[model samples]
Target: MKFPQYFSLLIVSSLLFACSNESDSDTEKSGIPAVITPVPLDTYFPPITRTDEWETVSIETLGWNENQVDNLYTYLEDNDTDAFIILKDGRIVIEKYFGDFTKDDNHAWNSAGKNLTSMLTGIAQQEEFLSITDATSQYLGEGWSSLTIDQELSITIKNQLTMTTGLDYNVEDAFCTDPECLIYLNDIGTTWYYHNAPYTLLDDVIANATNTDFNSYFSEKIKEPIGMQGLFIKVGYNNVFFSTARSMARFGLLNLNQGTWDDTPILLDTAYFNSMTNSSQDLNLSYGYLYWLNGKSSYRVPGSEVEFTGSLIPNAPADLYAGLGKNDQKLYMVPSLDLVIVRMGSASSEIQLGPSGFDNELWGLINEIIQ
Candidate 1:
């Protein structure tokens, strides 16, 4: 019965036009025209130094509209944003801190932490520690849920990653991971609900599969090698990650490069990486292993049953994908544009789990400045 949140917001619709301009005489003589290809910018291949500091690019050098950029910042401030950053070709283009927040201040990624867990799960699979196709009970032991052993064994790690565990989310606390809380709703792989308990249990899956603590495994596999700084802390039944804005950017950069950092391969499973970022199931074409995708024909939001038509963020590039969390902690990347953006702060007045109206509005502002 849930309704769409931004049903009335303006949807920007503009097709990217690729054309060639040539002299009429030449076109008539050859029956063809030369198409000019844009020279690739050096920013496209910026050095990936595994250091704390990142190289930066000036707005003037990028030729972005200054007045519009100011307007974008003003809009962000008005919306209670704490930290905002934009990376072009892995180099910082715009970085800003508002109120008392500083570059070094840590912020919780909330549900966005699921993206990290997804990556680690893939890494575990690559190392032959476990296969995602294996049943969840394989690692967590049987009877972890109140369901029968066969019913419990029906759910697989990939189902948890894709939110297709068919676990009942109608309990008193959706976030509760207790056996009593995880009741079965539909059969596995038949339903897609943004249930939290099944997703939260992935930490245990990774821990048992690797025979190491979740945080330690993450540190050894991803953080230390990529120069990322963060730690996952337990909050109630949820394991939320806290990290600086730049650290979040580093993760986005790693994903943007298809699981490689500075030519170092962190996730060697190309097939898994492709499947993780692309559509993982038919129920949610706009969702991939914990990541949200744009440019899809339709999308469904968390806590809502209605599937809205068109792209998730109309103003964003068609190739845009994101790790969006509560209160709009966002890690957005557009592969075609070679862009990465991060935003961390309090929730907007209107709240949803992943993509929201704020996304379209922010992208509108970005399009203006970058045009």
Candidate 2:
């Protein structure tokens, strides 16, 4: 029921050309109208090889309603989507680009790149480079935060991973990593706050733990293995990751496969993988290690203490865990469905941040097909 809107248009164009080329003899031999079927979707074969080739499957093969595709694209186009992709079993099911944005163009992951930090953290742990339970100061050194040394000692690497670092969220700049900016909000592990400073310091954590440069280590450990092309670029106090849409899909597929690529294990620590995608704390039922979890009975969002009652994306599958970033950058992984979805571009609306109405509305369209 779900496919990119462009697919049907391309097929219709192909059909029109076919009809024009048809001859009486050809028609007589067929005794019926020529049917145009795209061989590239499913028939192309294999998952992405990181080459120019990426296999695709036919919407007809999945029996999804093609009628909804146009509507989906209409909504996307209106919302300023630059690039969107849906991968099934690691094969691309839907890939659409808008305006001048193409497969080769780079886009920022925004906060969705936090998922990359989460993955690298796990890899750091797996390789015995760091432990999530270790105190943050143990790696970053003391006085990293304005908190008293005793109070600072209480903050752990797991706290950063879970957004429970107890760092103040009311500061003028939540993204500020300066020690003076990272004020103490509450006792460590007491509350779940969505602050970016502690999360961003994780860059230092990985770099220090691995005794190597952050991006270099990332490229060597995760990117190269999965054939991802992205690097963290320093922008003010934030180190934002930018890459092509296909690269985002590749990372989603890696998580969909539970940290494996082509049967090769990238994250050997099974426990970290399990914990990374599940609730890391009781305070936030809909959050894992920087990943937004769906299907929880209740959820919370950044800048709000009020817990909203419902799944993170009610229209999405219950098992979906996503990396939602600023301006609606998205990377969704549904293990149950063996699906990975990626969306990248400018904000569709004025309200910019993760988990907007855009998510629920878009999923409504997705459900029309996938359901």
Q: Against the true structure, what is every candidate's RMSD?
A: 15.5, 10.0
Candidate 1: lDDT over CA atoms? 0.87
Give the CA lDDT, 0 to 100, for residue 171 in model 1.
84
In order, candidate lDDTs are 0.87, 0.87
The per-candidate count of clashes, in order, stands at 0, 8
What is the per-residue lDDT of model 2 for residues 155-224, given as tens digits with 9 covering 90 to 100?
Answer: 9999998889888999999889999998887988989878888999999999999999999999988888
What stretches of model 2 exceed 4 Å from their correct place?
1-49
Per residue, candidate 1 scores C-alpha lDDT tens digits across 1-371 of 74465542322111112122334555778877556443337544333344545677777677778778888889999999999999988878899999999998999999887889999999999999999999999999977898888889999999999999988888899999999988888999987888889999999999999999999999999988788888999999999999999889889989999998876899999999999999999998899999999999988889976778998899999898899999998999889988899999988768777778999999999999788
For candidate 1, what is the TM-score? Answer: 0.87
Q: Where is model 1 poorest over a 10-residue stretch in terms of lDDT? A: 10-19
Clashing pairs in 1: none
